[model samples]
Target: MGKRSMPEVPQTSGPHVPVLLDEVIAALSPLAGKRIVDGTFGAGGYSRALLADGAEVIAIDRDPSVLPFAEALDQEFPGQFSFVAGTFSELDDLSAGRGKIDSVVLDIGVSSMQLDEADRGFSFMRDGPLDMRMGAIGQSAADLVNTLETEALANLLYAFGEERKSRRIAQFIVAAREVAPIVTTLELARIIEKSIGRKPGDAHPATRSFQALRIAVNAEFDQLVEGLFAAERLLEEGGTLAVISFHSLEDRIVKRFFDPAKGGPAQSRHLPQVETAARRWEKIAKAIKPGSEELARNPRARSSILRSGTRTVADARPTSFEGLGMPMVRGT
Candidate 1:
C-alpha cells in the first residue's frame, strides 16, 4: 500500500477536491485484487482513486445527477469499477453479490457538486428551488419550511444545525410564510437574515438554518447510523472501514462505533467493567484532521476528520441511533 500522486478526478462536475485523499488511501491500503465500496461516491473522487490503485470498486450515491460521473468512472475502469444508485444506509443490499468486500469508505454529508449546482438547492450562496431532497424521492426543504410547525422547525434547527437562534429563525419563517410561501433559497435566506442580523465578517446568518433543513429533509444523521451498522454487517473479517466526516455530529457517530464504551467517561477502577457486545472494529485512526497544507489548498477540508478501523472476527451487533449521539428532532 504505497502512496502515489493521485490523478485528477474530473468530469463536467464542479469544484470538489476529495478531502483527506492521501489519508483515506493510506487508511484503506487498497490492494490490486481487493474489493472496496465507496459508499458516498459524490463526484467519483474516491472511486477513481481506488480504481487507479487497481482495487475493484463499487460506488453508491443517492443523487441521480452523479450518474454522469459514475458513467465516466465505469468507462475508465471497465471491470474494476461499478456504480450503484441508492442510499448508503442500504449499502449491503445495494452492493449484493460483490463477494467479501475488503473495505468501505464513507464521505458523509452533502457533496460539493450538489452545492455548486444552484438548481439542486443545497446552498444559499445562490438562489435556486428550495428543494434539498437528495434523490427526488422525499419532501423538499420548502415543504418543511412551508408546513412544519414553528416548534418543530425550531427543534430541527437546534438539533441538526446547532443554531442558537433557532426559535427566532423559526418564528421569522412562520411569519413570512404567512404572507406567501417560502419557495426559493433566497426567500428563506432573507427570513433568516432578517431574524438574525449579519455581522461584518461572520458567515451568512442562514448557514446553520440551511444546514439543519438539508439534514432534516434527507434524514442524514439516521442514514449515517444505519450506514455504520450496514458496513459492520457487510465487511468480512479484517476488512477496512474508513469514514470522513465534516462535522462533530457525524464524527461522534464514527467515534462511538469504533470505541467500546460509546465514547462515555472512562470506567473507574472501583467498579467492574460492565459486559458489552464483543468488539467489532479495531481502529487504526481516530479524528485525523486535515493538515495545514491541505487546508490551505482546499479550505473546505478545514472541518473534516478522518476515522478508520479494521473489522474484527467478532459478530456484528445491533446499533442504537440515540446512543450514538445523533440528535432526535422530535418528528420534524
Candidate 2:
C-alpha cells in the first residue's frame, strides 16, 4: 500500500504551545549544520524550530500516536528530520555511529496533547477511562487503583505526589473499590475529592494523585535518570544538554545530574580538598522560568522551568539514581 500524506495539524488552543522556546534556542546557539536530538518530540514544536534553524534533528517519542505528527514533520523537512518511536533512554544506541551530536533537549512531564485529549485519560477535566500509559502498552491507572493495598497506595501518593492526605485518600479508594472497581478517571477523582474536601478556586483534588499514577504507569523517573546518562554518552565535547521540567521532582533530577553540589553524594565541607575526576558536564546555569509576558500569553507556562549545561570532554560516568532524591516506590 502506498503511504498516504498526513494532513497538517491545525493550531489548537491550550498548553500545547512550547514554553520558553526562544530561551531554549539561545542556549543551543549556532544551530546551523549541527546534529541535535529532541528527546520528547511532543507535537514536534522543538523539532520544527531546530529544523528551521538548519539543524539535522533526531527526534523520539514513546507514544505511537505521535506518528502522524512526526510524519508531517518528515514531509516538511525531508532529509533534515528523523523520528524514532522509542524512549530517550536508548538514545545512545539510537544515535550510535551517527557521529557526534551537537545538543540534546528533553521536555519532561505530560504533553498538553495528552492532557487535552479526554479519551487518552490523562486529565480529570472530562471523565474518561483510568488509563495513563504514555505508550499504548503498560499497566493502566485503573490497574493500580484497584489492586494496590491501601498502605502501598498511600505511600505511592505521598512519595510521588507529596500529597499529605495520602493515607486518607488511599483508605477511601480501597473502601470504595471494594464495592466495585474504580474504573473511570472521574470515579477516582470523586473519591479523592470527597476524602480531601476542596475549597473554592482550589486546584482539583485529583490533580496530585493522577500525576503520581501517570508517573508510575510511564516509569517516568527511571526513564529520566537513564535518559540523562544516554544523553551524556551521545553528546560530543562541548555539546549542550537542555532540560525543561514542569514540577519540583523533575527539576530536582535535572539539578542533581547537572550540579553535583546540589544532588548526588554530597562533598564534606570539613574534609580536605581532593582533586575531582573529569566531570561529564560543566557550566551549569541557574534555572530559568517563564517571564511575565510569556505567562500572560500562556498561563500553563507559569510552572515551567528550564535548566541547561554544556557537556565536557570527559568520559560519561556510570548512571546514578541516588542523586535524584526520589523516595523509593515499590513496584513502580
Candidate 3:
C-alpha cells in the first residue's frame, strides 16, 4: 500500500462530457443550500453541474492525476466546490462534519482522463506501464501479472473480465513471462493477442484481460459495494443516491441495492435479526440509459446504466460483498 508517482498535469481529454448528465441531474435535483458528494470526481463533470445548480459539492477521486481538474474547479466556484483525494468507499468518513449530504453521485469505473493518458495504463490502445492503479497506490498490474500462477491468473481473467479464453491466455502469459517479465500494457496485450488471434470487426482480444487486471488492481467491485453502503448511511432521509455503472458486474450491485428482494434481509450476521428499520433504499425509477444523442456525442455512454433511489428512514444495515454479486478471487 504505497502511493505511485503522480501523473503529469491533466492531458487534454477533450471537453469533459459526463455520461448520463441530464439524467443524473434530473435524479439529483440539486438546489441552493443542498450538499452533494461527487463520489467519483474524475474530471469534475458531475461536480461542476451540481455546483452550477447551486449545490455545494464535495468531490472525491483517488487518482492524483485529477488534482489539476479538482483544483481548477475549486478556484472557479470558490466555496461551492471542494475536493477529497480518496476513494468512494470512504465517502461517509470523508464527508463527515460536512453536514447531511442531500445526494451522492457515483459514476463508477475508469474515467476519460485516465484512458486518454497512456501513462496512466488504463488502456491498451496506447503503450504504457502495466500499472492500472486508480488510487496510484499498492501492488500494480505488473506485480499481479508477473507473480500470479497460471491457474490464479486464469481464474482472475475469467471471474473479473469474463474472458472465455482465459485458460489459453494465461498459459501463454506464463510461458512468455518465463523468457521476460511482462511489464508494459502493450507487452501483455501482445501476449494475449498472440494466444487468441483477433478478428476484424470484433473487440480487441486483450480487452477482457486488461479489464480483469484493472479491476483486481483497484479492487473495484469491493469499493463499489462499500461506497453504496456509505451512501446509504450518509444520505439524509429522503436523500438521493444515483449510481452510473459501466458494465454488468457493477450494474448488478446497483440493481440489488435498489431492490429489497435482492438485498435479502436487512440484518447483518453480527447484528440482531430485529432492527428498528431497514437502512436500504426505496426503489425509484428504472435503469436509465444514455439517449441516442448522448451516444452519438459520447460513445462512452454506450454501455452505461444509471440507477437511482430515494433514501428511506430505515437505519443503515450491514451487508456482505457476496450478497451484492461481487465475485472473489481466492488467495489474492
Candidate 4:
C-alpha cells in the first residue's frame, strides 16, 4: 500500500452537477434545522444544496484531495457544514454523538472529479499510473493486475465487471505482464483492446476490466453494504435514507437492503427478537431514474438510480457482509 504525494493545494474545478439532485432533495423532505450526512461528498454538490436549505451537513469523503472543497464550504456557511475524511462504511462512528441524524444521502461510485483527473488514474480515457484507489491507501490496480493468478484475475473480471470475455482478457494480461509490468492505464487498455477487438457502437473494450479493477481496489460493494447498515444505525426514527447508485451492482445492494422482503428471513439474528428487527425500514420508494432534461445536461446521470426509505421505530440490527450478498475478493 503506497501513498500518493499530496500537493499543498488540491486542484479546484467547476462544481459537479450531481445526478438526481432535485429527486434526492424531494425524497429527503423538510430541510430546515435537520442534521444530514452527505455520505459521499465527492464535489460537495449535495452538501452545498443541503446547507442552502438551512440543514446542518456532515460531509464524508475518503479522498484527501477533496478537503479544500470542504474547507471552502465551511467558510461560506460557518457552523452549517463540516467534513470528515473517511469511507461512508464508517459513517456511524464518524457521525457518532452528533445526536439524531435526520437524513443520510449517499451518491455511490466514482465522482466526476476523480474521473477528470488523469493523475488519479481512475479512467483509461487519459493515461496515468494504474492506481485506482479512492482512499489514497490500499493495494492499487497495478498491484492486482501485475500479480494475481490468471484464473483469479479472470474470476475478478467476471464477478466484478461482468466482462464476458474475461478469460481471453486475463490470459492476454498475464502474457503481457511477463514482458514488463502493466503500470499505466493506457497500457492495460491497449492489452484489453488487443485481446478483444472492439465492435462498432460498443463501449471501449477496457471498460469492464477498468471498472472491476477500481471496484476491487476500493472494496466498493463491501463498503456499500456496511454503509447501508451504518445508515440504519445513524438515522433517527422517521429519518430519511436516500441512495443514488451508478450501476446495477450498487443499485441491487441498496434495493435489497431497503426492501428486506426481497431477501428472506433474518440470516443474522443478532437481536433477541427477530420480528422486532424485521421492519427497521418503512415506506421504501420505487427506484427513480434521471429525467430527460438531466440526462441531456449531464450524461453521467444516464446510469444513475435513486432509491429512498424512511427509518422505522424498530431497533437497528447488526448484519454481516455475506448477509448483504457482497462478493468477496482476496485482500479486500
TM-score of 3: 0.91
Give me the displacement of residue 204 in model 2, in angstroms: 1.0
Q: Residue by residue across 1-332, what tens digits does model 1's lDDT show?
A: 34455456555786788989988888887468889999999888888888887899999998898898888888888988988889999998998887889999999999888888888888999999999889988899999999999999999999999999999999999999999999999888988999989999998999999999999889998899999999998997899999999888788888987885767677788999867767888766757998898888888889999999999999887766646787878763
**Per-model TM values vs. the true structure:** 0.96, 0.93, 0.91, 0.91
- Reference-based lDDT, residue 221, model 1: 88
Residue 329 local lDDT, model 1: 82
lDDT of 3 at 200: 98
- In terms of TM-score, the best-performing candidate is 1
TM-score of 4: 0.91
Give the top-scoring candidate (lDDT).
Answer: 1
**Each model's RMSD to truth, in Å?**
1.7, 5.0, 6.7, 6.8
lDDT of 3: 0.85
Error of 2 at 234 (Å): 0.7
Global lDDT of each model? 0.88, 0.86, 0.85, 0.86
Per residue, candidate 2 scores C-alpha lDDT tens digits across 5-45 of 22235454234778788888888978999999999988887
Off by over 4 Å in 4: 1-11, 265-277, 328-332
The better-scoring model by TM-score among 1 and 3 is: 1
lDDT of 3 by residue, 96-205 (tens): 99878899999999887788788888888999999999878898999999999999999999999999999999999999999999889999999999999999999999
